[model samples]
Target: MSSELETAMETLINVFHTHSGKEGDKYKLSKKELKELLQTELAGFLDGQKDSETVEKLMKELDENGDGEVDFQEYVVLIAALTVACNSFFWES
Candidate 1:
């Protein structure tokens, strides 16, 4: 059986692909796909930030190479950032 961390890693990859494949660059997530992914898979994380520009801001921040899309590596950075935030939240609680 896979370790908990391994299962989490696989879930992350699967989630990314599930959204990334919805449009252009089956390997990368377009702005629209990213927004959809966030809204669908991370609703709780986004519920507090009702800003209409949130997705655009995130796209600008996460598109490290400035390629106008989020590749897997860039996507991982976002996941890592969120994970860190979550860790801190738990620690504080």
Candidate 2:
């Protein structure tokens, strides 16, 4: 992965670990776990007034396989989207 992607993934993993109360471990998340984690940790950021529907749409778009869970690749895309969203929100406001 590129350095930026690596950093993003690291940030994501840390965020996941922190929220899941499994800090200091490198466990991979199941699809259900990922969904719950996102809802818990990212719901507010995602549901910002202007982008709530857009963000939900984006999540559905990424869950193409419809497995009701995102694997690592899908998770990475979600993280990337959120990172961009967050940066835009803070920097543009």
Candidate 3:
């Protein structure tokens, strides 16, 4: 049986790939795909459809190599940041 953390790791990879494969590079997410992933996967945290500038800003910030696409490394930064935020919120609550 997989441990909880292992399952969570798998889930992250799976989710990224699910969106990343939609167009362009199969391994990275294009701006549109990233927007879709954010809007669909994180509707609660980010209303991506409502605030396109936020998505644009995030893509620029997260696209470390500036290749105009979000690679796995860049994507993980977002996940990690969100995780940290969630952890802090849990502690505060």
Candidate 4:
């Protein structure tokens, strides 16, 4: 993977860790775990959106296989999408 991809992955993993309340090297996050993490960490940014509904929408959008869970690959896609969106927003402003 490219260094940029690696950095994005690491960032997402760290976010996962923060949400899971786990520390250092114990980085096994499940789909539900990721959903909760995203909701909690990104909730304020999501404004007053309903947490469950927002997570569900995100899961559906990111989980291409209809597996109802996001694995590492799916997580990467999610992060990439977010990165692009953030970049576009800041660049436009």
Best-fitting candidate, measured by lDDT? 1
Q: Which stretches of candidate 3 lie above 4 Å from their native place?
A: none
lDDT of each: 0.92, 0.61, 0.91, 0.67
Better-scoring candidate (lDDT), 1 or 4 = 1
- Predicted candidate 1 versus true structure: per-residue lDDT over 1-93, tens digit per residue: 999999999999999999996878999999999989999998987798964588889999999899999999999999999999999999978
Could you list the CA RMSD of all candidates, in the order they appear? 1.2, 6.5, 1.6, 5.1
* Candidate number with the higher lDDT (2 or 4): 4
lDDT by residue for model 4 (33-89), tens: 766677676666557887667777877788777756665677768777877999999
Identify the superior model by TM-score, candidate 3 or candidate 4: 3
Off by over 4 Å in 1: none
Scored by lDDT, model 3 comes in at: 0.91
Q: Rank the candidates by TM-score, best first.
A: 1, 3, 4, 2
TM-score list, all predictions: 0.93, 0.49, 0.92, 0.66
Model 3 per-residue lDDT tens digits across residues 1-93: 999999999999999999996889999999999988998888886743455887899899999999999999999999999999999999888
Model 3 C-alpha RMSD to native:
1.6
Best-to-worst order by lDDT is: 1, 3, 4, 2
Cα lDDT over the full model 1: 0.92
lDDT tens per residue, model 2, 1-93: 569969966777777665442322234444445555756777775464544455455557777677544455676777778679889999999
**Residue pairs with backbone overlap in model 2:** none
